[model samples]
Target: MSGTELTVTLSGGSAADARAVVQALEPTFGAADERPGDDGATVHTATFEHEAADRPSDGASADAARLSAPVTVTVQGTPEAVEKASATLSRTFTTRDQGAASGDQEQERELLLEP
Candidate 1:
């Protein structure tokens, strides 16, 4: 099994909402080290449990979501499967964040496999 860690920084949304989105994509991405949240679903940490930060501007409406966290997904399979999983995770998160913009943007870590 090969392990890859990706720290994803999601901004411009509510912490609760963003966490829900990430949790939703977990099954499609890979197994998580640990996950929290039920029904409303907010808060998830996979494997290493990357740090998360919620930054909300006073002027920003309460509906907005701000998320910054590292998600480390580990998959067991050929290199192709691992790569596919990475791409799938990135695309899924990006797709969901598209409709959730209040001038909010999602940031992805440039370096992969780094501690």
Candidate 2:
């Protein structure tokens, strides 16, 4: 299964909440390359190798769906993976644009997970 490399950045939430998000994403994206920011922010970056015709498993998807905190997430990937990730995450986290006029070149999207 050829997959695109992606990065997911998480910030603006408690450390525990941020960890939970990383835990949720691990099954699908594998172990994250974590970077803890100043204060209580954390970034979990990984690549997801999902089949072209498949969505992420419900179990793995729901891991993030269970969060009820306000955490911001940024995903960078191919258009398809970005869209799929946004939709999957929106099931539990509130999503919005990163306010970039054009995301075509960067292939990045950002979202805020509400508590």
Question: Considering every candidate listed, which one attains the maximal lDDT?
Answer: 2
TM-score of each: 0.32, 0.64
lDDT digits (tens) for residues 1-115 of candidate 2: 5655656777766666676666665554555666343453355444555452343533454555555467888878776666656665665456665642236554677787776
For residues 11-54, write the lDDT of model 1, one tens digit per residue: 33344544543454344444345444344433333342221112
Q: Best TM-score goes to which candidate?
A: 2
TM-score of 2: 0.64
* RMSD each, Å: 14.6, 3.9
In model 1, which range of ten residues has the least summed lDDT?
50-59
- Candidate 1, 32: how far from true, in Å? 4.2
C-alpha local distance difference test of each model:
0.34, 0.60
User: Which pairs, if any, clash in model 1?
Assistant: 13-64, 13-65, 13-66, 14-64, 14-65, 33-47
